[model samples]
Target: MLNKNLQNTKFDIRFFILCSIFFVVTSPFASCSAPPKLKTQTLTITRFDKSTITLVAEIAKTEEEKEYGFMNRKDIPDGTGMLFVYKKDIHLSFWMKNTPLPLSIAYIDSKGIIRELYDMTPYSLAPIIGQYACRYALEVPQGWFSANNITVNSKIDLSSL
Candidate 1:
């Protein structure tokens, strides 16, 4: 009886230690899992001079996708951005909740003309609201619009989206 009890205790201790090791090895990776896959399309911004700049834009069309937009991202390459599509024109608002990258957003009207632009601070919770109803919003790395001379009334070619 004494020998059986000793063996049982040893088994339980071994099992607990193995479980602890597994949890320790896996917990960090589980929390750092890869981001969800996103669909991409090309978007072009046409200036009044007829010059155009293009970007590879990730499409955020679903409610969940929109809610998760750019959160926790460490970097966004130049000439790349996220385009948010809505079912109807709305006075949309955005915030930088958990987003680490500084970005500038353009509010595009249904006619594909940009109506407003905002430079968002990283990790800011302050709401950035569109001045008018917009059907789409494009977010790019900070200073992208200014560097490219994109501004209000600049047209976006979203035919490829």
Candidate 2:
């Protein structure tokens, strides 16, 4: 019984140490922070083909908006979506947790050029990580990008708003 107790104690110590190490290593970099202030607004998106489509988007500019995201939402109105803005470029990561509507996300670079597009599954915890660094993310209804001819290199005219 004494040996069993010692083994358990050692395991607990090791577990605690591992957790501490992980925290120390990742503390400086914000993995996931508070949600940002989201606002319902509008923006014009210019496709690679020179066609433009305007959308009523909820701009996620604060930490609170980013965290809450589209969670618990049943639908995104037609011609409207959500846009996440970052101070600088980052490898954008997104997931659908408690979000019932399927979405397509576009990673936009600092120049407002669309760098990547990915379809996301509804209510999925699996992360959709961007392969390139970007300063903004736009989330719209699934197939919205393709249907509207929005593709890589498309511009999301971020200069105005």
Give the TM-scores of the predictions, in the order they appear: 0.79, 0.75
- For candidate 2, the lDDT comes to 0.87
At residue 76, candidate 1 shows an lDDT of: 95
What is the clash count of model 2?
Answer: 10
Candidate 1's error at 126, in angstroms? Answer: 0.6
Query: What's the CA RMSD of model 2 in angstroms?
Result: 8.7
CA error at residue 36 for candidate 2, angstroms = 8.4
Give the clash total for candidate 1. 0
Tens-digit lDDT string for candidate 1 (1-161):
99999999999999999999999999967645556678999887899798998889999998988988998899899999999999899999999988898999999998899999999999899999888999999999999999999989999987665
**Which 10-residue window in model 2 sums to the lowest lDDT?**
28-37
Best by TM-score: 1
Cα lDDT of model 2 by residue, 1-161, tens digit: 99999999999999999999999989965534544546677788887668788898888887878878887777787799898999999999999987889999999999989999999999899999999999999999999889888899988888866
